[model samples]
Target chain A: MRSSLLRAAHAPTELGMKIAFVTPRYGEEVMGGAEGAARSLAEHLVADLGHEVEIYTTCAIDHLTWADVLSPGVSQLHGVTVRRFTSAAGRDPKFSDLDARIRVAPSSRSIEDSVAWVAANGPVSESLVEALGDCDADVVAFYPYLFYMSVHGITRVRQPAVLHPAAHDEPSLYLPIFQRVFDSADAICFHTEAERSLVEPVLHTAATDQIVLGLGTGQASGSGRDGAAILGIAGRPYLVSVGRVDEQKGSTMLYEYFVEYKKRHPGPLALALVGPVSRPLPEHPDVVAAGIVNEADKWDIVAGAEVAISPSAMESFSLVVLEAWVARRAVMVNAVCGPTMEHIKASGGGLSFEGYLSFEVTLERLLGDAALREHMGEQGARYVASRYDWPVLIRRYEAFLESVVARGRRSEVKR
Target chain B: MGVDGFDLDQVRREIAAEVLARRTSGSVDAVEERRLQRLFEQYSPHAGGVGALSDALRSVDATIFIDPDVPVASSQPAGAAIKKTVRKANYWYMRWVTTQVTKALSNIAGVLHQVGSELDRINRRLDLVSNDTPAVIQLADADAWWHNRASEAVARAKGRVLVAACGDGSFVATLTALGHDAYGTDPRAEVVPTHGDSLDLRREGVIEHLDAVADAMLAGVVLTGVTEAMLPAQRTWLLRALDRVLAADGIVVLHLLKPEFLSGEARPVALELAGVEPLRPSTWVSVLHDRGFGVNLVDGGPDALIIASRGPRAN
Candidate 1:
């Protein structure tokens, strides 16, 4: 499905072209999908494609607070330069109050009120906006449009702007203000077709200048025993879920399902979750919550796991699913998520279950038949190799950015 | 032993032999050549074929949990294994052919399915707006009720009111008689009163005329029988345009024609108005709200009126 889009579009050129990426937050510690993707793309562009890439971001460590955790300075990661600026307005309770009001009592809010709400919803960096206006680059990309940084900075971007909205079925996207952001962009890049579908209706047209250029993954091929040792769950076979372990991410449903699975089929199988925990985990003996793992350990755990379960219902793109594929693990994803379902269907890499019955069936099948699991994992690995390896994917990324540059040049000529 | 007893070297040898045989027979076509080119392009980045295969196998072993007691192969750096595999797997013809055929078939099927889904989406959107209509006319009663309603509505209105899609200019005449400055705009140029020194009715597109209106100039808009005639997209445009021209407190009264009053020319006109389809009153109201309109639905048996005002977040 994605191949056709790539073939249809004009190919990009790789040279000394400079591209600047703008995001609300930027750091290795930043655990969000868009941030990670931005860092990956930025570094790869510089290292592999021989392009001059710079990142313009706020000096914030956490998205929840948008506070200046990192000192404002220019730093380099994998040859990509990252210049950070402090957000003039950080997090406030009023922004939360206004958001709640907008959700609960939409009628009470005016256009001005909504605009104010967006403003008060911090990461409102005047310096970032100024930097966008002054940036000298062939192309500037603003990511994950929910932020005040994107909403404010994207409009100010002087060069050709490509917006990676990273949008899902969320309330804030429904605001009328985002319409302008969509209109102002030179090109819109989607992480998945489902994200495109979600944005297309709001924009009133299937965007012609859009591409579903998925992110790349660094493949993991190590034993899970290393990860198992780190988590102190060395002996038992376990299925791992890697991400922020919270209820909003359907972690609660996953926990309940795992508990039920344990009861239904008694075995040495344990559910080991490794990530930052936002909510409390059940005190069940079979479940192990390994809090805040480093990248290497995370990959090791995933690599050694029996299966990878991702239960998030709202996901623009599941990096964990791609990572799981890279690790050669069959994944059990929530059937409700668009990106995960689409990925599963395209790769034939795993099974998806919407309810307890399907979940049980999928788990039973994986546990009972080792060959099927192996086959699925192999299928997924090939799919990832053919599509998402940085060596291959960087070309697509370059092509897309080049296409935007070409369009920008043409429009400039017309003017 | 290979990883999990899966011999990567044997698979590579089999592939290489198949490719060499095919090449020796001069059987590789342009399509086959392209497929092989794609395969090399995809997998050539990594160090060695065996190493790549080992990496893939490692992923598979970790993912597919079997009996740990099942003796697994000892670890090799895959450098020697990779060198042996790639050297032998140069003519891996069978795998390449299978991948190419599968990819082509999948692309074709996916394109067709996508087209079918797009058509389904359009059909579904049309269904959301389309309302059931009768075959023949019964507008005499409806026309009378609209005349009285327009008169009452205009009398209560504070400023100039525009009646969009006014069928015969009779409703505009009725509003003018009720001591209100009422102008009627209809799409059909021929529908204008021939004997007009009168400026009450004009043959103009409502959207164009509304666009020409000064911002916040109109005190009210009367769109009684037009919802059935307008496409969902056009209705959205009309509402947005109406929003631009309407005063902060301006009201729009949409007198939705009864499904029963639709017939012959009028019913077919509503159904067949290029891309326009009639929607249920409830659907229209929902659309109005989505467009930031504060709406009130007043039920009047077969005919209904939707009184809408621009909400705080109308823009």
Candidate 2:
């Protein structure tokens, strides 16, 4: 009883270091790659590193409307304290007009035009900006470079700001305003080496301040047989893809590729998709859309699969691919996604294809040769164990944060 | 009027200071927020309501100034004439700017075209120079390891020695300079600069040309660049194929990358060779052993050098 009381009263080293994460959207309902990562990392920072964590986010749940549906106040989510503020102008009807105008001719736009574009692009919350400025935290991390909260809020905060810019090679990234954000970041944490390489040439920041601290994946358990039985596919073999079933996530591409694969080579192999289906799946005997399975079942499905596919070309860091590797499953990824391709190249745990021909060949090789499949799976498991295990990743993250804080303190002393 | 008598500058300065303070406060205080709202309300109504009045004044001005029907003798007609002259001057200035911009763009395009052609010429010259000069092997540093290996292979074997995937043919040139009958083969020979014409270098596949060599005709074969790029099956085929042309006592030198030196991110150039997986030293040994070759490793520290001879083959 005494020990427990002491533990509750005086938490150990790095325990009281408060971190505030500013993302455009937050909560369990919000299902974006960056949001999910931010939430998970924040929770882990608190639970594992013993740090005090909070999130400052807009009251909007849906990214489409950035409306303040949630109450504008502080609330407890899991363990972290979430402060939700109102968006003064949420999703203006003329947002698309401004977006199109900017895209049509970005170079021709004046400073006022760009400013108006940012204002109309929605989720422009004066209150949120004020909250970010006033919030007292050791460090504030603004997620995803695209959102206005990250683009604008990051500069306003007095605390040392770290930008977890989930950047991709898109037209919006070329906007002149982001150049300042990237340049001003006290420390930048990238999800992958490719991401760092991409940002370094553009930002030209010192290497010491930028770190490639990839997210960790949970370990997988349970046999393939048990997982297959749980999914009601006891005997049938299928290729599983887990994520949002949308065109942007490359679900459409995966569906089309599977169709072409079936046309060329008819077999008992099926495609099992487990995610939030943004688009309706076409009726096919071989395709099964298991929408939003439980987390355990999702892991089970991954373990049961013959091969896991990640077809998205615009990924910053594919956590799903790492999960697939953890399940000892060989993965096939689109060659264009820098993060996934980097994973494949580094681990030699999976195969990547540029086109359908390469895909067909790689797929046939993995499916036809059981020994090869086993070898690749073993390679993947080893890679995940060595690099992505949570404990190892958490320690690295803790050390990186400690160093960043120390550096900030040194600069503060000098000031 | 009283409005003109009012000190508008003082009011503007006071309002600007109030807004700046509010913004810097980072939070809305109830009393201050109401004050700020009232200040905005005081001026927000008339901010954009002048459109109709401005349009009417502009029309009246245009009729008096730009209209050709206005009498030039009237006092107002003098202002109209001056306005017309100013409009024409502005139009001419714009036209001059447009013409200059067009000329400048045209000149830039011409220069770019010239630069493109020059680049093309340089590229062609580079291709020729690359073929004529030895290609720099961008891998492990060149040391006495190549010289020692070449000399050892020549001394140990009889008949013509072939070096496969001999990048740049510099090693072949070295052997030739030593008066040993050494020939090099590189599929990308056009890109790799070579020594003088006396060096026996061929622009073809090492395997395809090796098939043409007479049995027991070649004393030694040195395989390098493409060794790590072949699948285990392909490597097995290569060794078996070598047995057909190579003398029973001839030695085959396989230069592979040391797996210890390899990092997860350092992609060996050989990984791009289609239909192949990167190989480790152990895999090379097993592959060589499977094709009836007794293995001998030459430890050049960083390099994975293996010498293979015909022996009891592993099935």
Candidate 3:
């Protein structure tokens, strides 16, 4: 009996799903944005919908012991039940070699090694299946990529399963395994429309009915209604670009334009680029890279600016633009990416630029005219509030899970 | 000891000053407070308040007693005679001494020795309660010792429950082999393992009475050495955890380097704080007994190992 079959045999109805989140490591404070997001999502699922949630993860640096490797078992954490799977990564030399190989090329013997390692030292998929067999869940949602080996074992089980694909960057690298996973899953979820497009080729045309869950935006409050004079800008107040230092983020281009625009206009127009610069910038002072900032710091930066600028050519969804809108700051975006264009058209929040000169002019006009910035900022905030918020987004997620569970039940009935 | 170097008269004067200072203050803060507290709590006072004060003063007087420019007392009797004569002369001069000088000298020596002995006991008690043996073993000079030990231990005790005391969940990966019920506790923060589950022992007051908790449980207890010497509170909590959760019939394993032999260029700050003290076998036995645990000495040499069980109660 395969683990998935056993899991399916014991899986509950759609209304009674009890989801167990399995990860090699679990904790909100730990590394990796994906892990943090997963932890946050789990918390929301349990707190709001009364769904049972559990996270399994590794320990931090200080408290490791030998017994952890020897006796793999389940323990409770912050209302979640976590089961640790032991591996020989730290013990056997072969295991270390295998882990290294997997890092270089995930399709190599590393995948086999990981599967074998979990089967031998850590808990097998059977154990998870048996554990779930004891519980009553309508479906199991698997966060894939690193834990890909466990996916096939999970999908083959008795219950329905949903794959919440948190895809980022070029999707081609993972197309092979992702295609298999997509076919196996009863339903799929995408973080952005751009991400959804990336997987469109591999996904069947009929699967368009599958959930295209968009990345939700955060809350927005306070408007820059006091105008540009109170904001302390001397000349034509301009735009601000905020993001981490990455080549794709287009900080260099934003800087070049700012320099040119400053040369053209004598007024106190400033393009404040906040967030850390991972790469070196040319000697340009007006292009202020404020480095990494907290929420309060970002609010102050946005509140004083006439408009928010996003020059990223490949953003799945711009968290910075959402933040700017929340602060009631007018936005300027490059004509790239689906989310940015959709947001601009829907909210009439601000303007978009096809080239550098036009972007500079738009920024100058917004800074010179305080009334225009105010009007755009107010409209942007309203659009963001209605669409985002976890309360609204999570309902969509729940409905997607329900649909997956329902499809699985109907398929079983047909069989 | 020579009379000139070990002057009983001068010592006696110092003792008298200390006693007078303590009496006037109405508290024991004038002396080593921890040592004084232990003494008063442990020993039955033979003398009444005033007599105890006088005896204490007399003891100080006798410690400094010396012959005029003499190197050594001729014999034990002669040294005794000299001490008595000096105290007697002082008593006569003071005109308020009631006890015989010879008896007073004996009483003073006895009290000082008693307090010193009590301090030794407290130090030993502290060591037994807080020593993080498993952490010490994992950190032993051998590389990957934690991983190996965890695997081996789990393989050995497959069906039994394993309790990792004062462990952060890092060892959860290693202990995953044991198929046993594994739980961890740390007073500082809840260490939720990425691979396994961990209960926050702080909420259960496990940190406060770790020894009792460890002793009461029917599971094997593994203490991960988390710089026990640096953290006094963790040591206390671990000791209590071991005492409470460790099964009576179960083995309590610890891995620690003899404090004197700890390698890696010694940290001046840690040394100043932790201090260097040789771990003695007898010290281990005595300390464990004090914490309601019986000792079964295991591997030793430069690095020490011990397996202790809940010992017969003192009462």
Candidate 4:
């Protein structure tokens, strides 16, 4: 157990410690998952946890350059101090290797190019190193490690650093670089228990101290747990799948199965596929394709659903599943993904399927038995409240930071 | 002639004294005093010699020339007679002044009408410069008309395209079409991304970009109403895309709503917002110029019909 004194000392004072968050992209320009996570976490850290947090990221246009080497330059965003290094898209020698790869396979335009740009630019230039030398910050945190500027900037600063690896896929591919970065950090954080498990194999030392942080979702105050409609039945009752139309997201299987199931159930039931139609699907009046819904609309879909289906084969963690649990909707998951299975086992929120028949049978059973669905949903919501709320997750994060900082300080003293 | 009537001079003096008393006392009665003073001022100018004499006695009245040749007895008895004659003369003078004032006012009104007509002409010319050339101005007028027409058409067809062609991509985005696709082609390709999938522009290397874009396979294409102002070559490409690429049953809609006024010969610059660059109309027309499209005025007016078909046939 870490010392209570250490914990109390780390308890953020009312004055609040200054935290600089570094990312490849921040604000409204790039509306990706990492951007969403950074914004949500930053808000909670500042508003709920009593920390003054500012995010530093690169501009969409400014490719990496030697000129970005200056420390602590301010960004046009919300008065947050941002030091922008040129993007890797430009001609810089350090990124020559990654640029070679990109030239061969140019499909992944933005992310890979940015990483190469930062690597060539020597992370933060000497001038930017001098600038951060002047800043008064207790900690610098980096979110989702694509930005080389962030990795370079924080590592040189000698401040307690927290690296939150938001995604856990391609472990062997991407984890080694992160593992080294994490080793340098005072603490490491992951969003889900499943993510923590993936990293545990690499993290031989200090595995226990590294925390599994819960993602903060928007306030679900207006959501109700009961009386959602069952739209359609494939094998037994209606099951709905909501997600982007990608191969990784298994909506194709659902659509194929739903077509078969429609023949068996002669009654009026709906198997709605609500999400952005990334690819065109054949028109079916029975299947309501509510495309690209906003946040409120997404929650409404979840709340109105009897069973929320997640067939993702490659999700790091299913935010949609978490949302379904919050709405007290029955979550049906494919057991292949580490995060989905772990969440289901831990929360008892929903059923997981090992095969197609298992998914169909479980969905059928849930549909036929309303009592079982209701009880499971209740259990899920309670489990989510106990494990995933901001207060519970933020405390774990604070403790992990304290442990890291204490260990670092003790080591420094011994030396 | 009316000595039996109440003494008007005494009444005037009494009212004035009361007003002074009220004002000096600082009573709320000061409001009443002000009201009474206004009444006195309005009626004083027309008041007979009795009030005039009272004004003179108070040293507030100006003196007028009097004929000394007139006998004292005649004047004294004639005072009543004089008052009657003076009243008659005053009435005639007032009537003459009223007629002259009416004539002057009518003349002023005529001048004002001429000025107003001149201002309207100037305003119309200014509109040609300030309002007409702006793509948004013409777009808004066309869109409103298109919306009403499209709504009726959509109700009948159930599945048809509501094609809107304007330099303003954002406005085109707001139109309703069944399986709707809105195309706003411009030399500026940068603005295309902001309006999402439906908004597409013709670029310098459009053939290559189109091939790359078509590799993704869009569901439908919308050719909004075209204008003759576009360069001849670009119109040919548009026609080609329409005939070759557009599905056989796909509908092509056009808008020709004209504005009541146009801002003549005014160059309007697009305003830049955060994250979005401004694109001018000339920049938009250049797309057509490059594509070998020809625009003809459908009606004998400034309005035009943009005929979209296969590329222009060989001469």
Best-fitting candidate, measured by TM-score? 1
Candidate lDDT scores, in order, read: 0.68, 0.66, 0.49, 0.48
TM-score of chain B of each: 0.49, 0.50, 0.38, 0.29
Please give, for residues A1-415, the per-residue lDDT of candidate 1 as tens digits. Answer: 1122322342233335778999888777877568878888898988887788889998897656788989887998778888999877787767767776665333334567657777777777889888777787788898878777777777777678888988766556666666666667767788876777666655532322556778888867454446667778777789999887877677777887788678768988889887777788868988999878777788888888889999887788888998898888998887657888899877878877654545665677677778767966887898788778888778777877875775562121110
Q: What is the DockQ of candidate 2?
A: 0.01
What is residue B158's positional error in candidate 4, in angstroms?
Answer: 78
Q: Lowest-scoring 10 consecutive residues by lDDT in candidate 2 chain A?
A: A406-415
Please give the TM-score that candidate 3 achieves against the real structure.
Answer: 0.41
Question: Which tens-of-lDDT digit does each residue in A311-363 have in candidate 4?
Answer: 76556667778877888887888655678878877766677654333444565
Question: Between the candidate structures 2 and 3, which one is better when assessed by TM-score?
Answer: 2
Report the C-alpha lDDT of model 3 over B119-163, residue by residue, as the tens digit.
678878987755433122224432334445544543433222343
lDDT of 1 by residue, B184-204 (tens): 767665665632323345444
Query: Each candidate's DockQ score against the native complex?
Result: 0.01, 0.01, 0.00, 0.00
Query: What's the lDDT for residue B56 in model 3?
Result: 40
TM-score of each candidate structure, all chains considered together: 0.56, 0.55, 0.41, 0.44
- DockQ for model 4? 0.00
Model 4 regions lying over 4 Å from their true place? A1-14, A28-32, A59-136, A146-154, A171-176, A203-209, A221-244, A256-268, A271-289, A402-415, B1-315
* Model 1 interface Cα RMSD in Å: 23.3
Misplaced by over 4 Å in model 1 are A1-15, A104-110, A221-226, A409-415, B1-315
TM-score of chain B of 3: 0.38
Q: Could you tell which candidate, 1 or 3, scores higher by TM-score?
A: 1
lDDT of 4 by residue, B1-315 (tens): 113333323433444455355346664344333332232222122112111223222122111111122322344755767766665667667666666765665565556556657867888886544332112213345444345444333332222132334344554455433333333343344433421322332221222122222111222333332322323344345445444433333333343423222233422223111111222323333443444433222332433233322133211
